[model samples]
Target: MSEMFQTYERQYQELVSGLKQGCVAAGALNEDQRRPKVPELKTALDEGDSLIRRMDLEARGLQPPQKTAFLGKLKNYKAELTNLKREVKMMSMGAGAREQLLEGGQFTTSQEQRVQLAAATDRMYQTGDRIREGKKVLVETEELGVSILQDLHRQREVLQHSKNTLHGVDDNIARGKVIIHNISRRITRNKYIMAGLIIFLLLAILVIATGKRHQG
Candidate 1:
């Protein structure tokens, strides 16, 4: 929660507490004594109403999920304010009418039970909000894990392709080495054959020259 929202909430709680105290005090007093306190209770009620409106405005400014989380609290506050207003109205009533409505303390007990129920409901809503937040985090983490796996798969495919390309280059290099070795052997054999033919031609020429000399 924002600091401003916290401040508003604190003020609202104070108003609620003050209103409850005023109602209880007024209940104990006689008609004349309660008359003066009625205006004070009404003023606190108005302030509480205004604070709730402001708190609601703040809630509306929140993101949808957070706003939803705050709705239950806001609703509880409104209900409490309504109850306070009813109490103030009763205080403003004549003694006879007030006694008839509040006879046997049943109404006060019921009101206290409603307040407790509202508090419990607020706690339940908060718990639900926390659960939703945890679920959202888990979902994001799962998506991240999936994305990492996909990236690793792509990298593995690239590495495999590169390995294949290297193997093809190695095969071509091996073939080229064999062809060079064969060409070198063929050139050496042709040189030996040429040398033998030159030697035979010279020997034949010498023999013919000696025979000519003998005939002369």
Candidate 2:
């Protein structure tokens, strides 16, 4: 994508250079010679316009960061194209005026040309407006996507914390079981000791009573 952008950038620069050269060359020519140059300049301008639109579309398709990076350059290209249009318009007007002067004000072709140029300029402005709106939408969408990813990240953290808490609880339960088992063993041993003591006392009492009866 970067390479493609660079390629477009290079082409646009070349086109602009050629256009400027053409404008200069036309300016140095006689009206008759410059007459043919206007159409050629208009063709270059059209090609540049199309190329810029293509660049805009390509920029739109890029990632947010990449799009951001290209924005300045894109704006610069747009400015350049606008300047080229103005130059072409001025050249056309100059030629038309010279022809009208030479023909004693009988040139209606320039008026029609002006109207067409105005319409084309209006369309260019409308296209620019649409491109701006599209950029706004794209920014909003990128922000929404970032927000969603953050929410997902937070939820993942919560889930991981819950799993760790459950593991701790399991550990505590296992410890409790071991403690209860040890206590139960201690209680059984104590009961056995008490039984042995009781048996010893009973045997002593029997022996004493038997001896007493023999003496009597």
Candidate 3:
């Protein structure tokens, strides 16, 4: 059980690390795109993807009971990773579409390409807003995760202490049973010895009384 719990702890830490890294990477990607930062954005994206995959694989290897809770946390982190990926995709696509519309030399208001560009920009803005909200949520979840980890630590400590205490109680019960058995045996031996002594005394008195009657 301790081994299982350790496995869970390792997995939990990985998931938390993944969540924080992914959020940070997502923000970096957005900042890069906004400021025309190159290669660094791509580098950050690659690193984030690798970390996310590693954490996911680790999470999948966890065993039962602890696995249930571990998996739940992994799922939540996976969702966050997916959101980050989607946000990146949308931003990249929107940028490409905007560039294409500008290069086509068609500035007409009703042009199909123009409309698509507008729609893409709107999506980009929405994605940005969503990422902002997600960052806030991630911040709040970080605090919550810390509190939860602390709670788990304290709770496990209590459980171990309780288990040790119960083991002591079990040992005491077995010892008490043996002691009681010995005491009962001694009581039985005393009763038999006393009964035999009483019987011998009564027989001797009866014999003496018969002799006295014959003599008188």
Q: Which stretches of candidate 2 lie over 4 Å from their true place?
A: 1-107
Writing each residue's lDDT as its tens digit, candidate 2 over 1-216 gives 667777878898899999999999998987547756776787677667666765776677689999988877889888988988887777655445545555675447986676465557556655755765576567557656866787799999999999999999999999999999999999999999999999999999999999999999
- Residue 197 Cα positional deviation in candidate 3, in Å, after optimal superposition: 1.0
Q: What is the lDDT of candidate 2?
A: 0.77
Worst 10 residues of 2 by lDDT: 93-102
- For all candidates in order, the CA lDDT equals 0.77, 0.77, 0.62
Which candidate has the highest TM-score of all?
Answer: 2
What's the TM-score of each model vs. the native? Answer: 0.48, 0.49, 0.36
Model 3 lDDT tens row, 30-60:
5335333322343344444444444444455
Q: Model 1: which ten-residue window has the lowest total lDDT?
A: 93-102
For candidate 3, the per-residue lDDT at 152 reads 100
Better of 1 and 3 by TM-score: 1
Point out the higher-scoring one by lDDT: 1 or 2. Answer: 2
Tell me the lDDT of model 1 at 142. 62
Task: List ranges where model 1 is wrong by over 4 Å.
Answer: 1-107
